[model samples]
Target: MTNTMWMRGVEWLAASAADPRACKWEWDHGEGIALLEAGRFWDVLSVPERLGLLTLDLLWRPALPVPGPTLVDLAAGRVGFFLPPDPDGGWVGAGLRYATRGSWVAVPPPYRPARSLEWLVPPDGTGTLHSPGTLEDALRQANGTLAVLAAPPRGPRES
Candidate 1:
């Protein structure tokens, strides 16, 4: 199997942090409807993925330590995970770094667009972000990426 850029970085995380993608995700989770080739995805997950649900649980961190700047599908009844760039250059984290641009990224809960800062409300408020692993996994399970998952979260948090 071919190794994606991450695999090489996985071998040497300290060096990969300088990679530009790390910078992008460090600030923003991601956009929407992104495509993830298998090679890269596996590198981020640290598992062959053929391992199935076991891999899924680890990525979701159901029992493990979770990281920052994650992305997920918030569409009701169809939530899923996606691996954002490690935000740490893949040097010291446990989650995978998925390759994406400005798709598959839903505005986080209570997310407020720069222009709509005054109108922010529940789901529109930009806080309580999710794990990108869940976002990616949900899409793959959905059997399609073109299908954008729910609109971005609007407004502030309930708590």
Candidate 2:
């Protein structure tokens, strides 16, 4: 998907997390999947907004055979997770042998706007699924130096 489209999707996900009626169920990438439904993986969208957010993204690891949307919490400098699973099988991400069922992991930024998934550090594929409280803590500990990176770059000042 295009960058603008992706950003809009993420924004929608974040905004509609609370009201199920707003987040309608639909197929993603032609796969029969619900976009965001309570008790489903997409529930992460409901993550409280108090956590300074950078952007949310959908990770499509071809090796795994399904696509998963990830919430990129830049203020916390980590990729938050609460997904269910891929339709074909487990979820695939950077680094690691197999896929993870569901859990939160640190996605270190490269001190700039993320151009691709390469910018993120893959989850270890094992750990306790992060709670909203845990995510809040993680963001609390993240360095602020890169927080600026999350913002769109400013153009040259007018003369």
Best by TM-score: 2
lDDT of 2 at 135: 37
lDDT (10s digit) by residue, model 2, range 115-143: 22222322222322334443333444432
Q: Candidate 2: where is the Cα deviation over 4 Å? A: 1-34, 39-42, 45-80, 83-128, 143-159
Q: Evaluate model 2: give its lDDT.
A: 0.34
Candidate 2: residue 19 lDDT (0-100): 43
| Candidate 1 structure quality by residue, lDDT tens digits, 1-159 | 124432332223222233435433532464411133322222232222332233344445466344322223322212222333453334232233343332222232222222211111122112223354564454355333223444465798799
Whole-model lDDT per candidate: 0.32, 0.34
Task: Measure candidate 1: CA RMSD.
Answer: 16.9
What is the lDDT for 156 in model 1?
A: 89
TM-score of each: 0.21, 0.25
